[model samples]
Target: MTPLAISANGPRESYGDKLVLDGLGLEVAEGTVFALLGPNGAGKTTAVQILSTLIRADAGEMRVAGHDLAREPDSARHAIGVTGQFSAVDGLLSGRENLHLMADLRHLGRAEGRRRTTELLEQFDLADAAEKMASTCSGGMRRRLDLAMTLVGDPRVIFLDEPTTGLDPRSHRTMWEIIRRLVADHGVTIFLTTQYLEEADQLADRIAVLDHGRLVAEGTAEELKRLIPGGHVRLGFADADTFEVAVRALSRTLDDMPRDDDALTLQVPSDGRVRSLRALLDLLDAESIEAGEPSVLTPDLDNVFLALTGQPRTAVDPPADHPVDPLTEKAVAR
Candidate 1:
């Protein structure tokens, strides 16, 4: 088993009268992506701030990259890197210059800084835009450069807050690929917070859903999907007669069997388990009913999110034009 790169317990934070986090705990294994998901104002950013040592938690015990976040903040800072929702690139500087500045901040010596900067530019596919001013770079290029800057210190753990927000599909996929390579090639542990369910589904080794400053659910994508109701088996029939007969037979044994006359299909609520499927098949065999084909439709993350959060997937977005406060941004800088 991989060692844990991040271990936190009983984290609590409040912003004046509003409570942001309520004793939430988390664990992330090394060399894996741990995605934290939440709707708008669910304390996702607050958690990131606490973990990255950007803000001190009112109460919590946290160890990031094996350094105590509260006791040895400097050590923790040295071991981690953070990229917030906003771009950290210097718009006035060229891409190469921005990277060099980060390297200088980390005191990576002039010779080593140049070598590392060259390597990262090539790795992130920014060679062509190396000399281009950051303000003129495309959204994707800027994101890549932002991440490249985060890597300048060679930190073992990285926090990416809404890394792919507002990106087009192609750019989003490009960022996903880069994130995967970061873990696979460099063994970096990533803590990601994103509203995009598909991004979490594709990149996270495990996911946790936060609501109102608490962890409502946590598991791998498949495990989380299983928590939601609505999985079922769809049985297709060869003809109308067979469909009606099967429906009649199934109606006696099943509750709320949904039938589609036009399509000659019956939808039976199921857990999509093999044992249940075998039992269903056996029951149909006893009734002498023939179903042309059967397909299992399992619940997805969207369904899980809705069932657990009591809101549609679309509601997960933060309020329009909601800006990150300066305090939050300063915490990200640390």
Candidate 2:
């Protein structure tokens, strides 16, 4: 069994009278991406802060990197790295200096710090700008440098809050590849919160949706899509006779199966799962009906987010009590 890198049960928090998190609980396995998604003010940032040891929860049991949050927060911090929505690069320092500063904070010796800084500079393609002031780096370069700083500590788990907010198309995809490699090559578990629903679909192994300080839904992307309506497999028929037969066969199994007489097609509610498609084929085989290849249509993550949250993913929430964690932005900066 894989050990859990992060876990929380009945974790609750409030800012004065505004309840930020009401018993929000979650578990994240080692070497996997777990994305926490929500509209603004959904306590997503609060959850990140609590789990990453930047803030205290009002009540509950929480552990990160196998260390209890209450008793061993420093130990947990040693194994965790955070890159918030804002860049953490110190504008005064060069990219290389920024990384070396982070390594020094991790207590690495000068030689090891230099070696790691050099490796990350090349890995993140920042070697070209290694000697340039961080303030002069492009948006993508700054984003890359920010993440490189996070890795200087060799953290087992990372919390990323909207890591790609200002990236362009090519840079966005490049960052996605880097994220994938981190899990596959380094076994680093990621806890990500992003505005892009497609980012979750592309990168997350599991997703948890938060609304009003509570979990609304949790599952794989496809599983969550199944929870919404308007998913079906459209089976086209050779003739009216076969269309009627297919609809009659599917209607018996699926409630309110739709059909188009003029188009000679029947729509059976099903997701993109292979087993579901195979079962539909078995049913057609039982009836000896010759239905052409079926086309499946299911709601995407955008639709799923809207259906579950009662608002679009980009919609802003009511005024939240979120304050930027300066330490999280620059965990090792002096």
Best by lDDT: 1
Off-target runs (Cα >4 Å) in candidate 1 are 282-290, 311-334
Give one digit per residue, the lDDT tens place, for model 1 in 1-334.
Answer: 8899999899888766567789999899999999998888788888888898877888889999898987898999999999889898999999999999999999999999999999999999998679989999999999999999999999999999999998889999999999999999999999999989989999999999998888999999988987878888999989888888888888887888888899988889988888888988998899898886689888988888777777523332233224445555322211
Cand. 1 Cα-lDDT: 0.87
State the displacement of the C-alpha of residue 37, model 2, in Å, after optimal TM-score superposition.
Answer: 0.5
- Clashing residue pairs in candidate 2 are none
Best by TM-score: 2
- The stretch of ten residues in a row with the least summed lDDT in candidate 1 is 312-321
Residue-level lDDT tens digits of model 2 in 34-96: 998888878787788788877777799998888998899899999999998888889999999
> What TM-score would every model get versus the actual structure?
0.89, 0.90
lDDT of 1 at 47: 85
Q: Please give the range of 10 consecutive residues that has the lowest summed lDDT in model 2.
A: 312-321
Output the lDDT of residue 184, model 1. Answer: 98
